[model samples]
Target: MAVTRTLEADVLRRQDPELADILLGELDRQSTTLQLNAAENFTSPAVLAALGSALANKYAEGYPGARYHGGCEIVDVAERLAVERAKALFGAEHANVQAHSGSSAVLAAYAALLRPGDTVLALGLPYGGHLTHGSPANFSGRWFDFVPYGVDAETGLIDYEQMRLLARTHRPKAIVCGSIAYPRHIDYAAFREAADEVGAYLIADAAHPIGLVAGKAAPNPVPYADVVCATTHKVLRGPRGGMVLCGAELAGQVDRAVFPFTQGGAQMHTIAAKAVAFGEAAAPEFGGYVRQVVANARVLAAALAAEGLAVTTGGTDTHLLTADPAPLGVDGRTARARLAAAGMVLDCCALPHADARGLRLGTAAVTTQGMGEEEMPRIASLMAGVLRDQVEGKQVREKVRELVTAFPPYPG
Candidate 1:
């Protein structure tokens, strides 16, 4: 559907022109640049409309039909649609659509399954794990005993045998299988086997690949994992929210953990938006879009490799690809800024088992904008020029604007 922002603009402009100007500037930025951020996407206008709807006024403090508030009848509809759609999309026995963010979902899931001080096994942050997994600064690391597993130094792949050994040695209460920057398919079965051997609750943090799992482009973790956590944004291209899915046996625990435990009330507007995005993902076309995302990622990785950048794991089987720009004599942070200055947006990320960071690029946002394999080489060339200091930033920015104009992120 075409995006019509006239009403949004008028209302915001009348109420607060200063904030309205910032919003419009962000829209312009998104429209003109190549958004290569791994965890960001262009949510549909329908999703945006739902987020800005009257549903936001409601304060539904409990599950549907069992709310603490009196006037939750309409908000219940939105929450129910979101819950049911999520369950159907992921084939989960139960779904909780109320966690505030991916970190919230992870916290709630951990709370439901493990106790404070209980040992939890996960990938190390430096090896592509999320902060919630084990970083000392995060609540998960502070509250629980977070033991880390890492990718092999040479292969840049998760060492399953090492993980299995750690699982048996530490015998953690929970084992997490997922990543923030790793660029290959996860062996969920292997994780499941390890978790089973250790009698640990297997939690699959599918925040990065939920859409790919939904589109059957990646492995579904539901069957192998005891609980799955994800953000509605990212590859799902929905509102900025989080969800948890699990079997019926753990439904009550998970639900209670989310409400009256981790959080008090659900954001009904965002839940409504999640319903719309879930519907969109369920449609037949989403699968094609997801496949193209992977195709474009592979091409982009190869193109970047051709530019003398080291693509981690050699290439990608999903929407994201990580590369160390160190070979080009540029640090990840500098490369990110240089690319942004040239109208390409990505992030600096730590490579597997390395102290030095690298660039993490993803094709989800560009794929949402209808870019395909044909556009990958051009994007890679532009990014290389910026990072390698081969082409002037202004010239690359102009080329980026030209390409973005042809694509028109949000058609009206």
Candidate 2:
């Protein structure tokens, strides 16, 4: 499972020198920079190997033991392993690992439960929700009537009373409880209670915190919600793939929705990689990794707050922290660029109910690189200096490279 760049480079350089150059350049970029993006992670070499395996050439159009093609005898094992590992890892009655992305998983969940005109209550994009949850431009918004729920402006936390009120008023067919940028833990119990009162199916999108849930650092959403959708690449530290977990009752419906309704042929290679990640996650070492992810996030938030940035909700209970850097007289976009120039990558996010923007920082990727609580304060200080225009980005870049060199991302 060791990554051999020479082997891949030799193959690519023979047919596509330009692409080989670009791929190697990206690997170098990742090795040298601090990847602080909440939605990103460094997948294992075993995963990379699985993604590049011969399974990629197979065209298995259906589920295991029910493939439409004849040459799926071996690929069936990969798919079955992925499904079983996913179910065991999350304690779900069933799991579908065919969805190509987290957005696709959400689409499949909606396809299984709601009609085109059915109403769905979900968190708003500006309030930490993903675009698939119901942005005006997405198919979810175009097909169904999506009612938005948001955090309180004063507390920066979800207002369950308001959510309950909205659910009672709208009578949505489904209610989604999740966030892409929110820092605090989601109240799945509260969401379930509101959904029950409205006779709605509660879907928990655990894309950002599935690893924490697996490691017992966050509450499990599978027991509280009817269906859970997540991407394997975030805190889970797997390849870029999506999964939908549901009860035995809804398993058949969800499977049909994903295979024929939403996506076409499944990526067997990615499924193989997902199985590897799920197995790794089930190990005790992964639990320690996720615990440190949360611990490091808390340290990073405190360090940023000490530098005068407004850490939203005071601090984080998960892998990410949302901070309003407007106090430093810089917009989120500008701050992101400044940080990137300093070799510390992060995303610009919109604050709750405000026209201004903020930063969403995560510790999952850094933790994957062997960074701990002690390293977070230095990272925060570097980011703060660049955002406040106190030090040159080029100067900070040098410090970042020095730190990154000490902990190689993919050490052989």
Candidate 3:
């Protein structure tokens, strides 16, 4: 959809002409291209409207009912609705909607459970895990002792046995589960059992698959873990924010940690936008969209594999997949650049046992743009062309325009 700005041109010209022109060009480019980034999506107009609502003016420092500032009655209602809807959608005893992003949500969870310098076990970054999961350069690793486990080099799957052994040896305060590029369903029950053996808290970072879980396409981690942290974007298709859900027993600690421990005044506008998104996800059509997202990923994976590209772990059971570019004789960065020239917009991702020979592709953004099975083959063709060295920027750009034009975007 084309974003029509209401800002007067003369006003923008006087204030910041160069910056305004660049931003407008970017908006126009996005409207004309296809997006395949796994962690990105297009928010509904309602969510965007709420994001720019009057709620942005408010400053409600504390929780609902116990505010540190005056004139928060309506803001309190907006926040409570967000909390109630999130809890209902995720089947959690409590929910905190003030986290600014997934990273903040992880910090809040850590604050509630483990002290600084405690031992934590999580997946390795080279094995499809997130930076906050324990990367040495990240705050989590600097503050806490981190132990990591990797996927099997042979099966390209999580090595549960190795994880179990590590848990026994490390005796970590928390065990984090979930991945950014993993292609299979997570076994939360197994993770729970492992955590129980070590008397450690099970933390499920379902930041990527929360929407699938909410749609019943994936298993629920809340039943198996002590705490769950997820982003409102991704499959949720909500505002860019984070949420923490836990049992009633841990509600107080979670709330305190999110507010005074991690952040100050909440972004009331973001919270209200999150509430709107949660409401949209609860609709019947949203589940159908998620189902289509999984289907589209599988179709795209099969097509790429057929064209001689390597699909990590054979195929995907979720909305995202990793296409190994080693078979095409290229690094992830090169492959990503080539595809971008063709108007395809996935990101470079790590491959199993390889440093960086894979590209991550997702169906969420395009699916939301109303592209379906009809366009998957064309996207695959574009990818195949890039792999075969037959497509360049000019050719890909034209083909991409044709492909995207076939599926008219919903009016913004």
Candidate 4:
């Protein structure tokens, strides 16, 4: 949405034009470039309005009807709306919308369940695991003994048998099922079975696809996981925040883990924004949008493979895909720079079983911008040409500007 089409910019511009200019500059940047980032999307005007509401001034530090701060009766309503909407949207028995980010949500899940030095099982970092899963530099690894599982080297798919074997061997306290770049529908049932066999708690770090789940485009993990952690943005198109969902049995544990433990005061503005997004997702149009998101990703992946980019897993079933750019005479990092220069933006990710990095891009943003299956091939061709140096940067950039302008994210 045109965020500045609201009131904050007017007052801020009058009081602090310096910071106001920065805001406008960032808006212009987003408007001009193709945001193919996997974990991003265009939030609706309603969500933006909630984010800039007076709730931003509040400091509610606990659950509804039990906040420690005074004057929280109003913001409590917002939090309750968020909690109820989230539970109804995902069919969870309980929901916690107070976690600050996806990482924060994961930390709280750990605090609620496993103890320090407990063994945990999760996807390996090189094979699409999130840092919170077990990165040595992060608290997850330092606090627990993380046993890593990996995907198949040839198929670029999760090795479920290996996961089961690892779970049985390690007998971990908890098992995490999610990824930053798998580009496929996760087998939550399989993960659940493995966890059950091991008597381990299953935590679904579903930050990427929870939006899809909300729209019924992806499988709901609520039934299969002991805890589900997700971000409110991305395909959900909500504010930048995190939420945790679980059964009634674990609700108190999850709630306490979020408040007075992993985090302090909840951002009422963000929670309000999340409620707006949840309401939007429940609408029928959002279902169509998510379906198109996957359709666009499929076409884009196929087109990239046709352009010799070696699309990971041969293609994708989600909004994102990873592809090796070595065939285009450049590495993923170099390709990213070249594409960024040409007004196409994305991230570089580790290719499964490969020493070289690969490009990871998504259709969530572009799909929200209204480009569909027809535009996917053109995007792939443009990216391939840029990496291969077959097109001038200026020409590619001008074309990108034209495409984005034609499908302006917000129509004034």
lDDT, each prediction? 0.92, 0.92, 0.88, 0.93
lDDT of 4 by residue, 1-412 (tens): 4465653548888899888889888888888899999999999888988998999999988888998899999998888998999999999999999988999999999999989999999999998999999999999999999999999988999999999999989999999999999999999999999999999999999999998998898999999999999999988999998999999999999999998988999999999999999999999999999999999999999999999998999999889999999988999999999999999989999899999999999999999999999998888888888999999999999999999988888767
Worst 10 residues of 3 by lDDT: 1-10
RMSD of each: 1.2, 1.3, 1.8, 1.1
* Global fold similarity of model 2 (TM-score): 0.98
For candidate 1, give the lDDT of residue 281: 95
Give model 4 RMSD, 1 decimal.
Answer: 1.1
Task: Point out where model 2 deviates above 4 Å.
Answer: 1-9
Residue 170 accuracy (lDDT) in model 1: 100
TM-scores of the models, in the given order?
0.98, 0.98, 0.96, 0.98
Per candidate, the number of residue pairs that clash is 0, 0, 0, 0
Candidate 3: clashing pairs of residues = none
- Model 3 regions lying over 4 Å from their true place: 5-20
- Model 1 scores worst on lDDT over the 10 consecutive residues at 1-10
Collision pairs in model 2: none
- In candidate 1, stretches whose alpha carbon ends up further than 4 angstroms from where it belongs are 1-9
Q: Write the per-residue lDDT of candidate 3 for residues 1-412, one digit (tens) a residue.
A: 4444543244675699887787667766666788899999888878988998899999999999998999999999999999999889989999999999999999999999999899999998888989889877888878999899989998789999999999999999999999999989999999999999999999999998998887778888999989999999988999999999999999999999999989999999999999999998888888898999888888988888888888888999998999887777777899888888778888987787875668998998888878887678778888888877876777888888887766644463
Off by over 4 Å in 4: 1-9
Alpha carbon lDDT of residue 132, candidate 2? 86
